[model samples]
Target: MKKVNIIYWSGTGNTEAMANAIAEGAKIDEVEVSLLAVNQASADHVVNSDVLALGCPSMGQEVLEEAEMEPFVESIESVVKGKKLALFGSYGWGDGEWMRNWVERMENCGAQLIDDEGLMANNEPDDEAITNCKELGEKLAKA
Candidate 1:
């Protein structure tokens, strides 16, 4: 079975809900899923997984959450090379420039992105957005 790791950071549970949905979808494909908060996840889990799903809501000035997620993401940089990755997050404002820049950064680092990008806005995730997140999980599992 394929193993997928979902590591996420949420300030108000928005991104965490999305992470849970993604994990649920991944299970539809019979893939083993490990869903963990950013602090709880380790680089070793990322290195061993077939797919890496990262979630972090937009923070000040449209950037990743500084305290935990940023450090977590940075820690996996060396191991992310050649890994299939999917980015997801919730944004309260801005034009999703953060997600765009993040995707570019991951690609530049030699991590293969599975799709365009995964983004949901505000505190609640719409059905369409949730479905998209699920589809992202399926895609990542296949990749």
Candidate 2:
């Protein structure tokens, strides 16, 4: 069974909701799915997982959660080479530059992103956003 690890940082629980939705959709009978916070997840987990789903809300100036997520992602950049990756997040304001730039970074590191453009929901995820997140998870699991 392939392992799917979802690691995320959520300040207001918005991103965590999205993470669970994605995890729910990605669950397959043959795969092991684990959803974890940035504090509990490590670069080794990201490197070892068959599928990696990273989620974080846009922080000040539209960047990743610096305190934890940024450092974790930085540590895994080289380890993610040729890995199947998926990204999703929640934003309170501004455009979805954070998600876009994050996707580009993953691409630059030679990771295969499941979605050409990763999913981003403004503030709390609506029904449609949740649906999209689930689909993203399913796609990542299938990959």
Candidate 3:
């Protein structure tokens, strides 16, 4: 069975909602899905999963959450080469520069992103954003 681990950090519950919806969509006959907060996950989780979905809101200066998500991402940089990855998040302001930069960083590390631009919702995810996240999950499950 394929295992997918979704790790995320949400300051306003928006990204967490995205993660849960993704997990719901990823549940398939041959796939096992799990969700964990960034603080509760580790590099080993990323290493063992068939696909990894990461979520974090755009923090100051349009960057990743520095407290936990950023460090976790850095920890797995070497291991992500050739791995299938998916990224999603919620943003309160600015264009999705954070997700774009994040996607580029992962790709530069040789990680294959399921959605090249990743997924982003403004402030809070509306129904369409949630639906898109589920679709991204389905793609990740199939990847």
Give all TM-scores, in the order shown. 0.94, 0.97, 0.98
Query: Comparing candidate 2 with candidate 3, which one achieves the higher lDDT?
Result: 3
Model 1 over residues 76-100: C-alpha lDDT tens digits? 8888999989999998757888899
Per-residue lDDT tens digits for candidate 3, residues 3-92, read 999999999899999999999889988999989999999999999999999999999899999989999999999999999999999998
- Order candidates by TM-score, high to low: 3, 2, 1
In the predicted model 3, the residue pairs found to clash are none
Best by lDDT: 3
Evaluate residue 49 in candidate 2 and report its C-alpha lDDT on the 0 to 100 scale. 96
What tens-digit string does per-residue lDDT give for candidate 2 at 19-134?
99999998988888999999999888987899999999999788999999999999999899999989989998688999889999999999999887888999999999999989
Candidate 1 total steric clashes: 0
| Ten residues in sequence with the least summed lDDT for candidate 3 | 132-141
**Model 3 TM-score relative to the real fold:** 0.98
> Comparing candidate 1 with candidate 3, which one achieves the higher TM-score?
3
The per-residue C-alpha lDDT of model 3 at residue 60 equals 83
By summed lDDT, the worst window of 10 consecutive residues in model 2 runs over 134-143
